[model samples]
Target: MKVGIAGLGTMGRVHAEAYRRMGANLVAVYDANPDRLAGFAAEFDVEAAASYELLLRQVDVVDVCTPTFTHLEMAETAFALGVDVILEKPLALTVEQGEQIIRAAREAGRRLFVAMVVRFFPQYRRAAELVRAGELGRVSVVRLKRVGFLPAAGWFRDPEKSGGMPVDLMIHDLDYARWLLGEPVSVMARRSPALSGQALEHVQALLAFPGGEMALVEGGWAYPPGYFRTGFDIAGDKGLIEWSSDQPEPLRTLFPKDEPPPALGLPMAGLEEDPYELELRHALAALESGGPFEVTPEDALAALKLALAVRESAASGRVVEVA
Candidate 1:
């Protein structure tokens, strides 16, 4: 499949590398920053389109890896041009914009694949499978943690642009929690104030589902530089499941001294296959075969809704209903 990347940020670079690793036809890339555009073009050996429209014209699909605020504009443009869209997570800054993106895609008869890569992770996938197989009968409780350093990008520091830790960092587990359990009916949360100049934030959310299942999800950008961690604990009537990145295993992440903290999350330590590549491969195959995507547009919207509720609950110190 021919692919074009719409931004030269960290996530954009990661997607470009994943496409190359999968042997996809990476036609071109675009970025508003001239320096980043030029540098990324040279580094990837791909053409740099002067405008997003020009890049869209050259590929069958455009991967929108830009910031959260730009998602609506970029996705609408892709749909208008009859190109499939692979949008990065936190579908939009607001649920209204997310719904518009979905509406536009449907009207244009184009495929929209939200890049919720957590579902593609081997460990998470296996856990879901085990649950499906009745190994964890009547799962009742879940706890998830994703803590890391502040992202390197300036825009990420602005709550207006990145939606703070809830939408940017915690959305992964929020989505995963929903997938593992079910739709949450309400959410209660608390958060620390953003640190001066650092944009560091932390939040913990409690989600209640209609089936009496409960989840405690925590996310933060308050860790020391180069320190990142994630883990989960799941409990059910029949069994319990647990895993952590802190174990003396192959899943611990380390960053080089010269590199800045990653924009979204840390580059995972070691795995048999990269989850980003797995996600893209599935996207390509599903687009070609007209099969359903694992993470659909509605699923992305629902996740964003939950994350926004978390932010609201934290700010108000009240429980917010997942409407």
Candidate 2:
């Protein structure tokens, strides 16, 4: 299958490399800036499209790697041109825009897969398995923390393109929390008051779920000077499962053993595959089989809904009901 990559940013480049590594055809790439796609084109033997229209005409699948603000246009254009889409996280700048993209895809009978890459991470997969299998036993509380150095000050600091850390970064953990626990009925969040004359920096969200499961997600640019870290700890009646995204082992406690944890295959890769390569393989497999990718537009919508609810809660200082 021919895949066209749009937006030759860091993620675009990473995904393009992944597609190439998976042996999928990277037929064309489109980026508004020629310089952005230059290195990626050189690294991977894919032709860079001077315009998005050219890229859409050249490939059957388009990965919308641009920022959230631009997703709707590319997604609509691609679907209109009979090209399926692989949209980056936080599908669009706003829920209304994301909803419109989903609507267009359904009307066009096109598939839209959101790149919530963490779902494909082996550690997260295993954690989900444990939760589903009841090995964790009656999940009580889930706390996901993503605290690290912020991305370079660009659209990231701006609430328009990047959508702040709540939508840009924390949306992952928020979605995972919703997936692990049931859908949140309401959320309350507190932000660290707009800092440095910029957008809000740190955010803490409390989610109330059915079946007595509650989750707390904290995401921010607040990290100790120098290092970066992201991890989640889940607690249940039977035991607790902790996977530090950067650590070498799975942290677990069964209340009977004090031994060191088991070695968990790196989450960056799959059980026996690199995560990015696995993403490529899955996308290819799904496309060939005429099936939906692992992450559906609904899943992306859920993540976005949760993220927006958190933002509303933070901004209004009241519990915002999630739909």
TM-score of each: 0.92, 0.92
Error of 1 at 46 (Å): 1.8
Which digits, one per residue and each the tens of the lDDT, describe model 1 over residues 1-323?
78899988888988999988989889899999999999999998999999999999999999999999899999999999999999999899999999999999999999999999999987677667666766656889999999999988888888899988899889999999999888999999999887777788899999999989999999999999899999987787766667687875433223344555333332344356899999999998999899999999999999999999999999999999998
lDDT of 2: 0.82
**Best-performing candidate as measured by lDDT:** 1
lDDT tens digits, residue span 164-227, model 2: 7889989999989977886888899998876677554788999998676789999888765566
RMSD for each model, in Å, please? 7.9, 3.0
lDDT of 1: 0.88
Worst 10 residues of 2 by lDDT: 261-270
Segments in model 1 whose C-alpha atoms lie over 4 Å from true places: 249-271
